[model samples]
Target chain A: MKHQRWLPWVFLAPTALGMGLFTLIPIVASIVLAFFQWDIITPPKFVGFANFATVATDSTVQVSFLNTIVFVIVAVALQLGISLGLAVLLTEKLPNWLRSFFRSAFFFPLVLSAASVSVFMKYLFNEKFGVVNWLLSLINVPAVPWLTSPAGSAVVIILVYVWQNFGFSFLLFLGGLASIPTETYEAASLDGATGWRKLVQITLPLLSPTTLVASVMAIISALQVFDQPYVLTGGGPGDSTRSAVMVIFETAFQRLEFGQGAALGVILTIIIMLITALQFRLSKRFVFYQ
Target chain B: MTTTLEPRRTASPRTRPAARRRRIDWGMTGRITVLVITAVFVIGPVLWTLSTSLRLPSEAFSLPPSFLPLHPDFTSYAQVFQQLNMALLVLNSALVTGIVALGQMGTAALAGYAFAQLEFKGKKALFSVILATMMVPLQVTIVPVFLLIRGMGLSDTLLALILPALPTAFGTFLMRQYFLGLPPDLAEAAAIDGATPWRTFRSVYAPLAMPGLAIVGILAFNYHWNEFFRPLILTISEQNFTLPLGLVSLQGNMGTGSISVVLAGVILSMIPAFIVFIFGQRTLRTGLTSGLGK
Candidate 1:
């Protein structure tokens, strides 16, 4: 009995220890660290509500917070809409061989590293002789600074985020669509519904749960946009393209304000948690699981 | 009323057949339109890059761009090997991803076995803790993890990259779910046969749960192979850089755009993932679809 009792722990000990040290401790410490000021060389000093107050009032924080909102709204909304549309189209009674081919092609980018994608995207949008610009110029629209200007760069970032992530949501929606019984569609067809009318009435209502899950994920990911903007624009043309996480990175690493960065981290965490919980709550009304 | 009467009186047989054919043609056209649009949007940039990589600087910048490379060039691929040591980076990424996959699969399988089968105290609590940890983004702990690795003198070492990732909560969670689907009688039979728990896992449970293990392995492999941030922050020396970091380095080091080199680097970073997708397509697709829990 004694030997048997130790076996589970033996299996679990390493994982538990690592998670405790890396995950649990840091999560707790991140919240606690938000209340203190530390610069690595000096010992941390707790200043109860002072850091949070300062973060609330900081102009940089406000800008990033607003930027994050815009990013999440556009990125998440479009990602869900387009992916769901694609998923429906792909789930049609196509030949299995072609289905597999289309699935692989759609999912190709999902497997690539974000850094690689960012690099490629940068070149794709390059102004002077890049592909997108060249294509635009063919229609007489002239060049648009993709990563150089502020507004144009923001649009580019959103476009990249959508392109990279829609595959994931598309796959999820495909799975969900596949699970829907053929009887529902047959019944709809019998009612003389087809095309956009059927899509709006039948498909949209049935795919709500998948949409919720995909949207929540998209929102969380969009809010935490770091790698794309970081590598593609370096959050550049001045902090114009900087995201909320970019601000956190700069605060912690560049300025060495560890405590302030942790504060931003906590704020972001709270915001994400609240938003995600709200999504679940709201999904109760719209997301029909069955 | 007069127009309706005229049509009813003089309905043309040719017009009726043509109208029916047009209806059929419209559906086909709609499907074709959607497919063409998707193909253009998804495959266009990739094809453009491949062509761009094969062109000279003059050819690359030329107006009314040549769709195909007039004179194909392999210089960029050569440069990646000769100048950037991309082959070494590929080896590094492959080694790290492989080790991480093995460790992750082995650990998740064992841990998942304990969670699923063992009637241990704190089982539910421990599993909950793991689930909750999934919500905590890695961005919060990255600095501390870096500091931890640095303190251990493992920074810039492959160990720095591999060890921290061994206990993947998602993988463990996935395995637990997979194990739950297996028949419990196998474990019970093994126990009745005087097999130790370890023996039971190795012989019965592991084989029964091979599909799940493969799924976990693919996910872990893809993640680590494509992992960028940790390697970037942890490894200071260029020699220790993974493929993604090497690609970033190549991007930063380029002068006058160096389009071909960048494309070559992009292609280099893509090969492992592309190969994984090709070889493990079924497992990867099913695993990701299931793991995402839609």
Candidate 2:
């Protein structure tokens, strides 16, 4: 083949240029924007950490970050736990149709938009007349303040989030479980390992790498949660459900405080990077790649 | 840990008895039943939304909430159209999503093929940079992205939504994986026929990569179709709003719109996605599961 050195670059130009302009340059500009106070209407003025200081001390910003961390921990846990449990159960030798049926059922929610899911969920969790409280009454539990109270709203946000998200992790775990050789399970069975014993001693260890990936992805997305909180509680019953991205969205777009929004965005991005890096570092100690 | 995990020396390698495996274990049945119940919890809400949307507003809150839309009504659907520019929103969503998907498929394939087949300086570094973009959340870059859009004079336009999203790191990676899976002989055969690399790629390799491109296209369509955050930031006018944005504003109008009508809007937004799910599930599953395999 002739050495057409420029052919590759011709192919690479679009993605390379597009990512450079849209993603890479914007990232650099955002970091720079964090230090300057500017509304879109005016020239950006150098503020040298003033934006950061205000964002760090702002109570709403502080609480929103706190709410985000809490959401990540709880949502990622529930997402991984539910998905792993169902994936393991589905691993049992079932009819082919049954297996596909279970896979489809578990992964269905991944297809819906988060905004629409939150919309319907708001009605379902309504305090006065909703199915959730109605079902609770069947078991003699009294009506719960689902959307009206802070604790109730937080719980509803997490539930709605996990309901929509667990499918993704479930799909990953299923793939992980499928790749584990059947002979390993057979050997465990022959060694007189009970179901619980095999799950603890074999399955979980083998699935750790997948667990790491799922949790990393889950936590990153969870930390940036906006749609659910925005739609369901409107970040309300007070600032109980407000999130880091919501702060960014409102600060910049609603308030025209680009500097403050960029500052919050910078802080959020740093946390995401640090958490991701920490997960990789932690993975070195725990993930069992097979 | 090793002591408990040690295999018993006397253990036979042969499979367990067939009849024992064939026996209908109550525990297994219990597990499946538990999964079934969980599925209902996961899917029941969406079903209720669909059901409620099919009924009159007065019937939406009826006790023992109807899971089925028996005696279905089209009035709420009609009401959704009457209140919102249903045609305009759908067209906007379709245009943005369609263009973004096609653009991503093209760009990802080109970059992906370069990495998979063509040797270049800094290839590894370039690929890593592209993949690393995944870690940068849209929120982080959105403010600057907005400024850039304004700089381009594209603010509040559908082009604002469509253009920035054309470069997809994950799609490039996926297409790379797909290209690597294709047999190397196809390219070699083209070369033996004295075909240039450009001619070979156009006539030989690209056609073989159709299924791979479909995976990228479908995944892109699914993502951009339901995307809210970008459109929320980029598109301000009602005329330019996508389906998800339109639905959120519809929720904001709940003081006027009945619950059924609101849910009717929700159901309408889900139709294209649901249709894609039914037809493109395999490609989507393949793209998703293997997309994260790294």
- Scored by TM-score, the top model is 2
lDDT of 1: 0.81
lDDT of 2 by residue, B1-294 (tens): 766556543343444444455554777788889889998998789888888899888888888877787799989999889888888999999999999999999999988888888778899999999999988898989999998999999999999999999988998998888778877777788888888888887888778899999999998998889888999999889999998899889879765348888899999999998988889998888877776755
Off by over 4 Å in 2: B1-24, B183-185, B191-196
Pairs of residues at least 3 apart in sequence or in different chains that clash in candidate 2: none
TM-score of each: 0.93, 0.94
Model 1 DockQ (Cα-based): 0.55
- Which lDDT tens digits does candidate 2 get at residues A29-108? 88899999899788989999998897657899889989999989998989999999999988887788988887887778
Model 1's CAPRI class is medium
Best by lDDT: 2
Query: Which candidate leads in DockQ?
Result: 2
Tens-digit lDDT string for candidate 1 (B134-201): 88776777656766777788988988898888888988898899888888888788888998888888
